[model samples]
Target: MDFQRTLLIGGLAIVGYLMILQWDKDYNQVPTTTQQQEQHQTVPSTEDAPQLTQAKQGASDDVPMLDSVADAPTDDTAADKQVVTVTTDTFAVEIDTKGGNIVKASLLKYPVKLPDDNEPNPAPFTLLERSSARTFIAQSGLIGPDGTDSKGKATYQAAQTNYQLNGGETLNVDLSLVDKKGVKVIKRYTFTKGSYEVKVSYVVDNTSSTTWQANLYAQLKRDNTQDPSNSSSSMGMSTYLGAAVRGKEERYVKLPFDEFEEEKFNADVTGGYAAVLQHYFVSAWIPNQEQLNNFYTRKAGSNNIVGFKNQNNPLKLAAGEKGEISATLYLGPKDQKRLAELADGLELTIDYGVLWFVAQPLFWLLTFIHSLIPNWGWSIILLTVMVKAAFYPLSAASYRSMANMRRLSPKLQEMRERYGDDRQKMSQAMMEMYKKEKINPLGGCLPILVQMPVFIALYWVLLESVELRQAPWLGWITDLSVKDPYFILPLIMGASMFVQQLLNPTPPDPMQAKVMKLMPIIFTVFFLFFPAGLVLYWVVNNLLSIAQQWMITRQIEGQAAAKSTK
Candidate 1:
């Protein structure tokens, strides 16, 4: 009966955990707003410009003529399009001069795969590409009268086809274009030695007699195609692939591809950022903090666009005057520390489920431990030890309660046999026995309830931490983020769980006893698909728990025996 009650509590905790995961998935499916409906109706074809009357009217009173220019022709000639390559320590980017768009970006340090026979030397991980089947690129342009942008019908000329950092502190790639009206626009891309962020700025030099007026727009364009490399062991474990926007009222707003197709997101925010997020990497455009910007997310045919544009407060540059508009672009692995430094709430991209408050500190601790011990696997082991030590007193009490119950198991069985079919009498007799023994029937369940959040939070920390990707532990444990190659750790965990179960008191009910006996097998099957790091943590934790419970039970039984003899 006691075991049945404990199982009920465990079942409730598992149900709650599953509910949180489901809620998070559903939360990303945001409701369609009225503005989104209007924008959806106004979204024009690929060959035309999006109608801006509704958006312009909704703009702040300060800006009157805020509108987006017509999109560039989809069938632009690629034969003559010049490609500029910028090589930095962290990444290599290829930009097309047609609109100064970053069409191809490869993480120079990260390989596409750990090792493969087909490709002896695997290529670098490609973050952005422009192929016939897939189109993912970072695009920016100017919108308004006399503005020359890549997204528009303006072509730029690059100064050089290749630019290398070559151990230098900074490297710059310049793409220049002169409008028919003689407005010279130089698009400069600045890359640092060891940073993924590229500083993109446009130097608009008005060479004509009239003033140059336009708004700078930057966006990420990608299709709904999923990356084959992001597969998980199960369907429920798929990573989120979509857009996220940070604004004044909204901290972290997710705009999924399906949701974007149903409704667009349009808002004006100061110090905002728009990003396209995937499993381990993210590409975001963070505009100047002091400027008010218009952030939007919409779908164009098979592609999804997420971007922000500086408010249409025209950069009125007179003849011979030059104006520079700049923003930072981040394209690399989602390192929480670096991402947080880049923009507010950017670290949220490394999702830790719904219990972020608990997961964040746990991740910080894990990182700190990793700093001290280079091996992430060892860090997880030490983290489990620390967590167990923190809850030692509660666990000891729970163990002692179970020990008391185990000591009285014979009496409990006799009472059950005597009361046969009378459940009321059996329960009453069990309550009296518990009261006389000064044992709390629910004490053993409390420790488990308390540990559930910590364990679940650590699960996310292991799942989301890129530092564990391809990280090796001992022999055969090549990637801590992946399942054990031999399934040894899971088997060991199951053995330890079985040992711990044997130490607990047997349930009076035969049905409950059978269910309890199968728990270790059930958990072992589940852990077979979990990451090695998480499985390692559970194995270590279970071993330590068995040892602690054994010692506590022995002490309690010794005292009870002495009292009975006296």
Candidate 2:
């Protein structure tokens, strides 16, 4: 074909290839499969409801022991309510719209984050009540006149609103306590949604004259419902108190929720299990060491207790008195950059997974490169260009080989027609001819092989990079993290590939020629499920390569004409 026709065919092939990729993805139905282990697992117990222990009489007044009331019905099953559960490979969430609380959130993944849609059986945080998606409710019992006794149970109302988030939306959770005593306590929790850490501001107002005192605790609890028969049950649910601990050798210090208020104590056991949440780092509005003992966890399971410090001043609430305190909760994810943005010391929350040493540095470098440009899509484009440029010498060598092969096509065709049925002789002659021309037959394949690693690295960069979450590109490409709604980029990519194919003359070997002809179709099918941004990068690179090759081809033709004249 003439050069102009070659370019048109190549361009059209590429466009067609990309279009096929996009269309194939649309019809590609990812089969849903559940593990047999998951189906056989036993249901978790929502019973054993968490309760604060009170010292029985006859126990020393100074030493108050914590204990649970045995007969306090813990059955979570309610009449006439449909409970919806969402689970992943590691986590299971039981959302009860009837109770208005996430009754149980079992941590199947030791360190998990909000699930992404790409995950199989993704468990997302959803609004129980559609009428008010932001509204969340909890039941904390009423305070006695003295503020220490339970007059009755009072339900607490917490609502998370104004969630119109565009990358940097702040979470405002309003927590209120409504009681029959005409007493009310309204607290607000506010923090940027971009980071998982949270801050709480408590405002308690009581119209009663009786003094009221209440203790505050940050609760992080999960149910263990995994069937004992399943291997995952042992590794199922885990909680890190303030921060995630690194390495497998060190385990969490287990303490009971109640044991924290007392003086010095320690417990240790070899066999059974008990877990204590540890803070990789913590900042709290609590008191000093001199007033009370700092609580530590004993490896023992049976004697677990919470760590605590004595109150420096009474949370005194007289008639018509209002008390307010503001504290922050670092609910950070296991992502370093996000954790780091939670005011320096907060990055301790990112578990780093297993490969923190290597992954951390890679993440840092990716973040640094991304910071240079605000558009995440462009950042990816620039990153791809840099990588390709770094390996340009290899690519150039491959292109040069193809150029030489194209120049010798006329001579190779003559040999092919002359020795049509002499397969062995034709192969021998082809090799001898290549040696005479000083061209490497293996040249094109080596560079393509070397490009694989860079491609894999970039793939990980796009998949793991949280910075790209909800990030937008120019038009119709609102979320680079998700698939493109319009398949424009992929179509362009396929067209470019077809163009690149046309520029390089076909091989004389029948088998090799057949494979080359099918390269565009083979690649189009492969690119179907690839992220739109990734396909776009390939399209741009292919187009750039086609232009470069065309220029080289023209240069060779011009030189040959000049030599003929001389």
Candidate 3:
């Protein structure tokens, strides 16, 4: 139970685990299909009508529904209609008049990158967009019996094409559609200052004699286009880019597009929501918490649609009734604080893998440190110091065990050489020597074994935290979430690892010694691709361990010198 040997084996095992993940990432890429997302265009025949992002089919049942441009005018093609633009302090969104749907959204606060200080970063990060090459947008409307969006996306008219929240608390961009019977449904998107949540509500003014009863549907649609937000797609094992929903079975469930072909995700959810998750951002539609919601996933054309509809409790209104039904739409960064406020489990979108329980506390601690330190890089170093301090007792015990083992290494080697191939005699001699020295071989390995999970969980915390994206530590290290551009930190980490290993007793087995010598090089290569924050943690830990081990080894050597003098 030599600690150095165990540590080598454990380190190599970790490298093997990472290799497996890299292999999966290399092979498990969702293949791009020859199928392009059918464009939202108008057609005459129901059979010839183009499939849209919605889950509904035109000829499905007694009520024929056509999804297009959620807009098809009986006379004029609405494709040429203008897109209403709404701007606030936080974001800019474009609403296509044909469907009165949110076709594009860009976060004003987040830029693509801050490459140089010469000029301000010009482009904001665009989350949702609809174009020839991409179709990732949020759509919401009234559907069911007398559904305004059922006939086709009824063309809506806006008072002004551009609306901006200038010195205002809230901005309301309304798209109004009127039926032949004079029923008007105003689809409104309300945005408050400094908020990512949009309250999308349908105001139904039933001017007809018949009652207007229609259910509300809100969904996120996207093509299998590359995730623009994920800068690490090429780095391997990119963060999850798919759909996540709060289901009846699990608090957080991911429904991949490929899974739809095999088995669709269908469930009746209450106080639940569905979201399209990407690298650092998310677009979710949270239906009424009290209403019975039908969550679904389907492959329409080349688009993957994940959404929820109030199917069980349709918005029923008597003739000439004035009523409304609404759902909250969140389109922004996956800010845990904002998301948690919107829904019960929406914050789970941050995704820290299987060790989320451990990762969460680590994040909370890191964030707490950041609040005090004000810089993420410095925060990470302090957090590392704090973590080391917390485990000081265990680490001290392990270091003492290693120091004793180091002191006994010569005699252990003597026993090995004296016994030669006499294995039984060599084992007996080693045990008797260990007992005489009063050193437990298992002492060092077990403490490190207990610390492994915490370190791994912290790795995930550094890898997954969006706050680390584009966050700078110091000169040349602009982003903590991505690999160090110059490979400086990893090299330092490797050097520290070698120094730490030199303080431990060498293995009696030459083959094990050789393998142990290469651990630093192997680990350095692995960390070359890891995010800078994680590498920083490892380097700091190794340096601190070396300081502690060196002192203990020195004390033991001094004691041995005193005994020889006596």
Leading candidate by TM-score: 3
**lDDT by residue (tens digit), candidate 2, 443-525:** 87788788766665555545544455556777887665445555566556766778888888787767998888787766765
Residues 1-566, model 1: lDDT tens digits? 99999999989957865664466456522223333335534653231223354234332111112354223323243346677998888888989787788988989887665664655576677788776435688887776666664223357887678889996899888888888888888889999989999999988888899877887888898888785335433322666788999966967888888887678888888877999888778899999877788888776656788898786455679788989988999998989989988888888988887888999999999999999999999999999999899989888988988888899999998997899999999999999999988889888889878878988888788888878877888888978876675667978999899999999999888999999999998898787667788889989999999999999999988998899899
Alpha-carbon deviation at 445 in model 2, angstroms: 1.9
Mind sharing the TM-score for model 1?
Answer: 0.83
Segments of candidate 2 deviating more than 4 angstroms? 1-195, 198-334, 339-366, 525-529, 560-566
Candidate 1: where is the Cα deviation over 4 Å?
Answer: 1-79, 115-120, 149-153, 227-229, 232-236
In terms of lDDT, the poorest run of 10 residues in model 2 is: 127-136
Global CA lDDT computed for model 2: 0.46
* Rank by TM-score (best first): 3, 1, 2
lDDT of 3 by residue, 1-566 (tens): 69999999989967875775576468733322222223323222131135442224333111112222222222223445678999999998988887677888989888776655643554677788776656788877767667876665667899998999999899888888788778888988999999999999989898899877888788888888888777543463577889999998788998887786567787888878999988888899998888778887776666787888788788887888899889999988878888888887899998988889988999999999999988899999998898898999899899999998888888888888889989899888888888988989888888998888888888777777778878999998888877776678988999898998889988878899999999998888777767788888888999999998999889989999999999
- How far off is residue 343 in model 3, in Å? 0.9
Clashes of 1: 1
Query: RMSD, each candidate, Å?
Result: 9.5, 13.7, 7.7
Clash statistics: count for each candidate: 1, 21, 2
TM-score of each: 0.83, 0.48, 0.84
